[model samples]
Target: MSVYTQLTDDQFAAFCQSFGVSFARAIPITQGIKNSNWFIQTTDDTDGAPSYVFTLFEERPPADIEKMAVILNQLDGKLPVAAPLAVIESEAARTDNDKRYVIHYEDKAITLVPCLAGAHPEQTTQAMCHEIGAALALLHETLQALQPSEQYGVPLYPWSDVRDRESQFMPSDEAKLMRDIWHAYTQLPLATLPKGLCHLDMFADNTLWNLSLNNSQKGEARLTGLLDFTEVSAEHYVMDIAITINDFCTTWGDAEQGESVNFDRSKMAAFLQGYESKRPLGADEKRALPVMLAKAAVIFWLLRLNVIHYNRTEGRTGDNIMVKNPDLMKRLSAYHWSHVEKAQNTVFVLLNTHSNTDQNNQIVGVFSSITQAEQAREQLIRDQLTPDQLSNHSHFLIKEYTLDQLL
Candidate 1:
């Protein structure tokens, strides 16, 4: 029924016929904002290669599509990506009874790419983070070697480049905060931030993880598959790492309770540790990362709001690319903001009651609960007390004698 799906089917059949194979079946896989994909099985190739994926573009302008097609064909052997390989060219393409299926938007076209086989990680595990990080580092290295131009298929971030337009979608208070933060972010002096190719929106959905079959004795799980390269572009490469870390650190609602999911700072450390081994980040890049992470979280939260506002009640069929779980979004936004806030506050580990600090110096002496840290700070002010004598000092801080104050 959807034009996107039909066009994809037609394109697949055409590609099969061109390759001299009889297409017996086309199974739909994933259809998104930019493309519709299907798993194509044919009886033509006797070499035992029985499968391929057909991806038809839904929104690429003809010029961009043509440029993208050429770039993908050449870069396929180079990148671990989901870029399509052209089996059938536009010039010799066949027409169909269904006009929409046959006609390319803006005289556009389609291409087929082999689906990289593997399973995706469950948004947990240190191994998965390490792999993703290492792969991203490899990608950055590869892109760094390439010359930039139309062939590179550079991407544009509409919202970040247009925060005034984005603020309209946020809640009033958050919106004000967004404007201030966004302006400050855009105004940042990032003259020397490293730049290269980036999987700008590389989230859990795009990455495929390979798992060990239950009966197989292999102890390792494979996390190799990746998809949806429409957003792949040449840009500030560190944005990709920031996005990956943000996703890796996310925790949703109660459904994930009692699960083996926890953000091991070790994983974050390992990822950056590995990346730095490959390509080092400049001092400015390191400083800008926390801000960029905050920006990523804000963009997703606002975009989720847009999706809920437009799609929830309308009953329209489309891809889940932009779908955001409100609960998860809120949680992720809160977490990212906390990290940024803490980084800004120049405090990493907090000496709260839950921490393993020595009891004598712990915040418990001043505040009754974790929530009381703020109140304790305020109380110290009201009573004009010292930070140490004010209560809420964690056990880690050794106490110097306060007898001088007594005098």
Candidate 2:
């Protein structure tokens, strides 16, 4: 969308010729926020398929972009990702002997990948959340197995940049809130949390879902693509989970100026359940979820503020295509911190019953309040358990856990 380096028809054709491809057309893709992208139609003489995506990196360095290619290449066939295509050098051409998959065009790293199928979901459903969670778990597990020598090298947060530019913008209430959240984030025990390769930004727009035409179950969608790994990095797994939940499991109220974000517990529960089905979360990760949620909000808020200030200071160019409101994350951070305890305090009630034939354990309910959970347990014991089972306190189990603990 952001055409930092505009290419003419002749230029594109020549570029394709170097890569053993015949170019048909190049249309700008306007949906993305970071790099400049083009939907390219090229004739693949071998297969006749002619869809591809061309990207011109705006901010990332050539080395980092090459690392991204390696990451994507490692993920090919394992996950639904569009990996960068290897460049084919002409036999007569003598250039840098580095076996890289990226091309330096207009002094920026450029890459071409197959255009993946499906579209980003406008509104993510519970089933979609579950599928995305499971897919993310698989991504983490697979990357861990690959054990790439070069770790994901993106910065976790741009705190220094934000701090440097804090005085450029006028101070406001939201600004004060952001400062407080940043201070709190600094105190978190991030080193002890589980670490993995994370898709730091798993927002709905970065994911594509394909729904079956004759689906037997209603509201089911399959994840067809996970795009835009420019923000991928090595970070806490729980922090990645928090970032995703903040986006996918939250609904926003329409506001012309500032949006109101509300977390959906049912959707979150389903997502965690799906995640645990693949890789179970640790106890430390469970206890750190609330703080991680606030941290994720803080990270995005600061990044948005930085983007706004950078564009203003440097003068908006075609490369500066994204400008998100900082107030939205400010409100979200405040909401999550203000209601942290309530969101974390959850309890599960399990009712155990045994017959002469077999033993059965059932999760009767989960409640936010211990009193409600205890009441449900008492009712279940009185109605479903026998006198002998009631005398011995072995049949009913009421366990208290934070929202993350349920994962």
Candidate 3:
């Protein structure tokens, strides 16, 4: 059910009066998705007066709001975040509201956050990527300062887990595949891998840029404000980068011929430089990155598919996690199909080496262009082969499939 909140003129006046502040008007500043958002404006507009963003988590439970607030407060200065400010105090705090200074609006917590100003970016340049990298590095550096966030649900829930979702599709094969993939995911060395703050959903929209300085490059945009810490889940920080790459800088974000998602190696290099400027990644961190990317790809695929497969016309009550992004889904699908080869193709001057176990293996080669990977995978998979077969065999398979057959 869609939550509706109507503050008549009288009610609005009384509410503002309770806070000892008067407002000129309330504008719908929120780009609401699943929840409602509004901006409260005061008539007294000086050069730098404060503004507030009213976020009504209509479907979010009160406990969740409380927990999210606690997490945000802990992450305020530490992470690249804009946390909410509550006026009422919880009974534990021995202050006014006796319930964490939060207002109950339609049974959900209504939070008024200090609105920060920043511009939504269409593209990012190398310098901007560097800033983001730096921000994330800084976040990772401060991870030890805060405790792990409470895990309400399982970290990665495959579609197969839900019987209803399985029944919705043909033969339940998709669900079976998802279940199998989920098992593989859990079996991976997740526990042994590195751990830190992961912004699980730091899409470009979550980041806000200010035009403090403008150069020709998109990645070099000025650092303004990083907003929305609601999806700050715990994991390897690189998981955040993988999600970020898929969302903003990868082919997935590129929709048109000219409107490309710019991935400047120099800019990405700068980002890495900035990240390493703070807490540098260890050998272990680098080795685990591939599996982390794989995890991100799986999550990204399901996130996109859930919206299309499950919630076509109905109001999305389960989550606004995945809205319909054809480009994102397409790229994710492409990545899923090609990641193994793409990983091989991305090898640089670094030599391939293994310490006796599959998990200890590492390959290094020069990164290939997207065109190169596509051409290579086509030739490699002309004749189907399993992972073991592809690994053990020393022969190319394209000569087996005829052009007409392939066609």
Candidate 4:
């Protein structure tokens, strides 16, 4: 959250009072890029008074804010979501026709939600990754059951709108790389993949975790909250998984050569296992994962670039605003593509192979080709799963590899 619209102390207090909480102070939150947010403290000495987060819609309209509020309220206790609090006035004069949560200010909407507990993890653990993965899948299942209208849905990505901006703001090579990745993603059987409303921005900073009390006991951190529903939209379930993995599974390090971003394989496996425990991924989703990972990186890369472009062109500059580095995402995007290429170029060079299928002379050639193809994919499968786990996912892996080859 950034400070685009400054609010006076009186204004903040009045807003809090309308929700029946006496405001103590407003601490500006400068972590995110879109909305203006403050960690609000209340003056009440009551035993159950809770701290809140105040938000001003910097870029979103009132209607969008209202929809977000509705979505959050639906997900409130089931997940650790920051659902908007109903205003006292609205609760008193309740009616089906009137919206209760969003307050329309001059030209924007303001909402107050209870601040959740726990801190953002500085370094991610496999345990943490597992919890968030399961949480994301549950979010998908719950939201899909609601069957939200397309009118409130967001597109997969704004390729047409952002293509020109990418060419203008990025180096030629970087822009071209993005285009290639986008093209690959679009070629997938998107319609056949499972569709649902997804939390597109499930970054590590957007989640809160409670650290284990006994580090020596091998205890896992508990996921306390999932923040920032502003980017939630209807999309393929696999795309959502990719977006979460790009942030959760990659570790950043600085080296003598340059900045390095590498995937933590153990953590990635743990996450996938956790997700599968709730809802197993289909063969199509498995096949689409690689390109989607690259595509997800492109989205954040373009987003960071667009933020810089707007900050300069629109004269929105100050210490209060934070802009992330686009080069980091560029590096991530490149790494994903390189990893995919390495997986694809792996030669089977089988000396001896056995096939379970007994077929006619004509079909022997085709069966032999399929056997060789599976051998080629064996290394890639090992890269993702341990030898022990391979038996469990072999069918899914084969189907995924077959489809990927066809594509």
Which pairs clash inside model 2? Answer: none
TM-score of candidate 4 relative to the true fold? 0.82
Which candidate ranks first by lDDT, i.e. highest?
A: 4
Q: Sorted on TM-score, highest at the top, how do the candidates line up?
A: 4, 2, 1, 3
**Cα lDDT of model 3 by residue, 86-174, tens digit:** 55333465554333535675677666666667766766664566677777777656655555533521143444444345336634654
Q: Kindly list the per-residue Cα lDDT of model 1 for residues 1-407, writing each as its tens digit.
A: 02343645465566666544467567766423335666777765456444666656655555555555444444456555655543333544545421121224335555555667665554455556666777777766765545674356644656654456556755797666566556546855556677766667677667776666661235355555666656666667667787777776453334547322234454565466556667776767766766676666667666655555545556645543434454454445555555555444342222334345555334433322212233233333335445665444342232222222452
TM-scores for candidates 1 onward, in order: 0.69, 0.78, 0.67, 0.82
- Of 2 and 4, which scores higher on TM-score? 4
Off by over 4 Å in 3: 1-21, 30-32, 46-50, 78-80, 88-101, 151-184, 212-220, 251-268, 307-323, 342-347, 350-407
Question: How well is each residue in 223-290 modelled by candidate 2, as lDDT tens digits?
Answer: 88888888778888888888998889887666662476777755676677667778888767765776
Question: What is the Cα-based lDDT of residue 399 in candidate 3?
Answer: 20
| Per-residue lDDT of model 4, residues 97-122, tens digit only | 66578887898989999989888876
Model 4 off-target regions past 4 Å? 45-50, 90-93, 96-99, 154-157, 212-217, 254-259, 347-407
Better of 1 and 4 by lDDT: 4
lDDT of 1 at 198: 69
Best by TM-score: 4
- Show model 2 residue runs off by greater than 4 Å: 44-50, 91-99, 146-152, 167-172, 212-217, 253-258, 317-320, 341-407
Candidate 2's C-alpha lDDT?
0.72
